[model samples]
Target: MSRRSEEKLAERADLMVEEEALRDLAAGGSGLVGLDGPGAGTAAKSAKAKSGGGRGGKEKDPARPRQPYVPARGWPGAGGGRVGYMDPPTMWRATTVQACGMWPFAAGSGSPMTGVPLGQHLFTGATVCGDPLNWFTRARYISNPSLFMLGMPGLGKSTLVNRMLIGLAATGVVPLVLGDLKPDYADTVRALGGQVISIGRGRGGINVLDPGAMGEAAARIGGDAGEVLKAEAHGRVLNMVAALITIVRGRPMDDHEQSVLSAVLHHLRERTPPGRAVLLPDVLRVLTEGPDRVRAVTLDRGSDTRYRDAVDPLHRSLLGILDGPLGDTFASETSTRIDANAPAVCIDISGIGEADTQLTAAAMLAAWSDGLGAVAASHALADAGLAPRRWFFTVLDELWRPLRAASGIVDRIDALTRLNRSLGLGDAKITHTLKDAEALGTDADRAKARGFVERAGMVVCAGLPKTEMEDLGKVVGLSRREIDLVSSWSSPPGWGVRGEDDEPPGRGRFLIKVGGRPGIPIKVAITDAERELHNTNTRWTTNEAAVERAAARIAREVARPAQEGPPPALAGGPAALALPGDPGFPAVEASAGGWTA
Candidate 1:
């Protein structure tokens, strides 16, 4: 046959198959392919008869008894060609971006098999996996190794991180939990045979100013050896003290107060023994009588008085830290040291309950600083060609409290966030909300706080309420489709039969946005063994019930005293009264007959 005739025959064959399918469908048949039976053929013939057609009867010329009313069996038998369908040429109108997005499957676009295995991609069944450290190290990938995870509580945020950390640990990446407020990671850490440092008053201590770590940190940064080491030690101590004092005073440090703190740390660095830690008591004593007193000769009378004034308030603030709930947590030397090469370490701050945000922030700072120093030391030793590995991960769970403690504390956090690359640290900050940025004291602090999230290499965000999507989109640069998918991943408004035993959609599901790349929705898939070890889901359990009851009882106890009488004045003790007329530190008093004096 001619080529044109061959094409015409193929088209006829495809038409015949489609006609047979239509007939079967119209006759209340499934139209399923590859079926052969008497009932199917009868159904096809009956439908063709209803349509007033009988095996192309008009072309048959009334030949051979009209083929005994037999239906077409298959496409090749129905027509004359060997194969069934020959589809016509077709094209879809779409932009390059849209077309590229739709090739094969939407989720199959640009997902590489790198880093640790996360889970299956939402749209496509392809595996989606990436680590912040791996992405940061790759050329032109992510700029920073910091990451943020935001989700509602009990929606697998903690559980997901637990899985990721475990995966990273398996790959020789050490996971250090900077602050575990809920104390949920202890089981995972223990299961991995890692260390858990319980940080609280008297339960354990984390000396924020451990000279040994500070000295090692100095050695790592590569400076004029001992002097560089001492200067580094002084700076670390200064940062810790300034942040602590700011938290204690509920404000930023003034110039003279900052100057006094610097001087005191400098003096302590010079006077302390080689291996002694810089305790808060040492800082308090130096603040009271060291620099301002020694520098008295250089200052004129008014300046001297101002110096004395700043010194006393600074002294009281430092004194409060030495005497407050955090004193035992950070005053002495660290009882348990986080090894630089340990597979995992979890600093449990659950001992400091919700009532003490300040204590929680302080302990976090101490532990994080210590961990940073250790990691830096490891990196330095690697530089010196002595260490086995040079990377570590710092997981900051419940990160908001420390970020919102004070502006100075935010500065410290920014420093750590910026140094993530050089020190080989991948900081994964976990939080329930992003409002912690707005809770900062100043616009600058808020911007810095948000900038930390902005600079992250990846953000694993789960479901958020409708109201929060707009702001979250702005903060994280989520696309419209991404926001829609987030809503899809959220639980439906009402329930149905299929959903009765269905797990909440938001749990274990997350939108993973690699820096400036299309966000891939993924879930944290774990083995049964992993599920038991890293489970943080306390909801619908007896433990949850007990926690609720205890919280209620504590609330009642706290409210009963307030109901009985007015609050006592200066319950903050001398720290509230020792600001030396600084208006920033206001002192209130109760007067008789319900009047202010």
Candidate 2:
């Protein structure tokens, strides 16, 4: 019963089992059939096989039987196989305060879903809704209720503003497109059932002397508020007249002359009949006549010569406005005034050619005066409890034109930008580049003009040149990636096949930058209706069709014999002329006789 003797007996037992299993294998029998031992099951055999039978057959365990073959199964969802339905992941909304606590590990942020839905975010594909007033009043995202939009020409600056106009109008905010140089918003205003007041030569008139809605609003209220409004109306007229004179004279008026003009306007208003609008002619006539009020204000004591000499410049400037190129537009009585009840209104000044810088400048100033006067009147009535409170969305497009036209205009726009929030007005200022402000005449004017962009609640930019981005960066903070993204959009379009319309890379792409926060890049999406309503290329397309038609007509005329009789050179026979679109007719040149092949 010693330990060595017991081990020898166990070895002898293992040898006997091995001989039986090997003999059974040699007889072509199943080694695993009816196996009865400690390691005689399939699992024990599989484990031994996986261990390689103790590195060699000599050391193989006989008690464990061999395992049977079994094929491997494939994954059900692989190789385009059917898979069981999976429960979709759920998403829950939370405020920022709640989100910070609930999802403490999440990173990054997105534009808030507040204000007008302008377009989709460029990175996260989230819808971006933003504007100055909406973001300020609703979301408390920005402090200023004004927006400045800068972009290259033909880069959807006006289209973006039009989108805001359409959206804000739906929210019961009246839109006022003051001095639409390209008439970009006229269609939008009309589509919104708003009034489109055209001001140009032979189109319509806006007498700067006419108080517009302010006068009417002042007349309706009879308390101290009414007197305050009346005084405001007079100041508006005086300032308008002064602005016009500055535009015509190419310089700001002196205090003495301004006082004389102010006094004359007061006297004219007092003498004029109620319900009648004061015209520029009335202003000029009153200045020409040396009335007591005019003399008193001029400080000319019973000296008609000194009085006439003093008021001579003011008299000539008013007369110039009455008889100048803009006479038909600004000198006459008001033809059409903005309708406050309408959802939107635009002063269409596109009829005036852009080349006439002074006229454009004067008309734009007058339109601003008139538009803001109407807004002031609305507030007055609301304060008096006679009308419901109203909010206005004011758009100032081609802002540089007015600024460059008159240095004084900068002050007026500066005042408006500062007071927009208090006046219940949300305004957008649009221009080609920041240099437009920098190109102003005076240092003071340029400084004030630059403030327009600086004080904007938000800056919405489309494709802009790298140089412009540099200038813009000085006013607003922009990162390298944002700069590159914006500059890339300004790249020239690739050449396209004939008859294929090539769209600019940044046609509707915009970057909304508020303060130093991460920028929200968006690609404005326009509907078919909006595309039609906001088409700024109508002039180009129409001109192309017109040119094609003209070419065809010229070709027909040249191809046909002259009814009156051909010139002496072609009298012998009708000239052969290849019509447009004919084979080999790449172009036609006109000779003295007619269009040649």
What's the count of clashing pairs in each model shown?
0, 0
What lDDT would each prediction earn against the true structure? 0.71, 0.82
Scored against the true structure, residue 406 in model 2 reaches a CA lDDT of 76
Tell me the tens digit of each residue's lDDT in model 1 across 1-597: 897797777677556666766776676765533435223645555656666665654332221121222333233444553444456677343445767756564434556567777777766657776778777775446788878988777677877777778878887888888778777788888888888888887689877666545476555555565456557666766777777777788776787677766766667777887656677777766645646444553243557566666467777777788787667776787788786556788888888878787887777777767777667666655665655765777787777777765456577678878877877778888887677678776889888988877777788888877556668888677788888777665664356667555567787788888666788888666678877776565544477777899999999999998789986787776566766456556656766667542
TM-score of each: 0.67, 0.74
Sequence-dependent TM-score of model 1: 0.67
Q: What lDDT is obtained when candidate 2 is compared to the true structure? A: 0.82
| Per-residue alpha-carbon lDDT of candidate 2 for residues 444-468, written as tens digits (9 for 90 to 100) | 9888988898899999989998888
**What TM-score should be assigned to candidate 2?**
0.74
Pick the lDDT winner: 2
